[model samples]
Target: MDTGTLALLIPIMALSIPLFRIWTKHQKEIAEMEVAKTAERAAQYAASNKELEDRVAVLERIVTDRGYDIATQIEALRDTREVEGLTARSESGIN
Candidate 1:
């Protein structure tokens, strides 16, 4: 209502507009960065899933193939471990 009060209010209003604009711009940039990070993480998960699927396919093939001999291979691995255990025990005089 008075000229003195009006003069003070004018500068305050003028300064607030630019500060609000700057704050909104900062918020927009943060949102964009979060979106980019989320997309990158999604891509990494997809690649990992693809690798696991490939490994599973290989395992399925090995298990289904007639000549693979899964039982024999497993027994062979167990035998090697038992032989190593016996050798270590004998060397340590643990009977």
Candidate 2:
């Protein structure tokens, strides 16, 4: 209302504007830093997941190979038993 009061208020308001701008700029910088950190963490998680997947694939291959080997051995044992039975029957002249 008075000239002196108006003069003081104008300078205070002008100074406050720049201070507010500085505060907002710092907040934006902090938000950007947080985003960057989150992205880095996500990338690390993805890499770890990929490594685990690769390890599982290798284990699966090994298990499949071992299973096939075991199956082949079992079949060979069955064939050998049958052959032995046939030989014993023939030698004893039993049908």
Candidate 3:
């Protein structure tokens, strides 16, 4: 209200301006760092998702490829087992 009080307040006001600027600058830097971290995490997630998709594609091929012939594979395995059993019985001379 008085000239003396106004004179004293000017220096404080000037100091506060610089302090506020520094605080806001640090806040902006921190926000930018968080943005960068979020982007990195998103990239990692995308890479992981792509890897999973590739694995699923391989599994799909294994299941759907005609060369995999599930019935024929099972029949071949059964034949081998029967042959082994018959051979074992003959070797033991058991009917």
Candidate 4:
């Protein structure tokens, strides 16, 4: 209410206005940077998820195909032949 106090308060209030604006501006910049970082991380996660989905789809196709069992049986027969051939070669000492 007194002139002395009013004069003192006036200059303090004037100085605080710019300081508050600067503080708020810095905080807003920090928030924007965090948002950008979050978006980049989300994009990376999406790409990884898509790659995994593709791999899963390929595996599902292989597993569900009717020919898969036949293919596995053929591979087993080939493996048995290879093993028997190795055993025969070892027995005959044909290194």
- Measured over all alpha carbons after superposition, the RMSD of each candidate to the real structure, in angstroms, is 3.8, 10.7, 4.7, 3.4
**lDDT agreement of model 4 with the native:** 0.95
Off by over 4 Å in 1: 1-6, 76-95
Runs in model 3 lying further than 4 Å from the true structure: 71-95
**Model 1 vs truth, CA RMSD:** 3.8
Q: Per-residue lDDT tens digits of candidate 1, residues 6-94? A: 99999999999999999999999999999999999999999999999999999898888846688888999999999999999999999
Total colliding residue pairs, candidate 1: 0
Query: What TM-score fits each model?
Result: 0.68, 0.61, 0.67, 0.75
RMSD value for candidate 3: 4.7
TM-score: which candidate is best?
Answer: 4
Per-residue alpha-carbon lDDT of candidate 3 for residues 1-95, written as tens digits (9 for 90 to 100): 99999999999999999999999999999999999999999999999999999999998887888666977889999999999999999999997
lDDT of all predictions: 0.96, 0.95, 0.95, 0.95
Candidate number that wins on TM-score, 2 or 3 = 3
Candidate 4 residue 45 C-alpha distance from true site, Å:
0.6
Q: Write the per-residue lDDT of candidate 4 for residues 1-95, one digit (tens) a residue.
A: 99999999999999999999999999999999999999999999999999999999988887788656968888999999999999999999997
Top lDDT: which candidate number?
1
Error of 3 at 37 (Å): 0.9
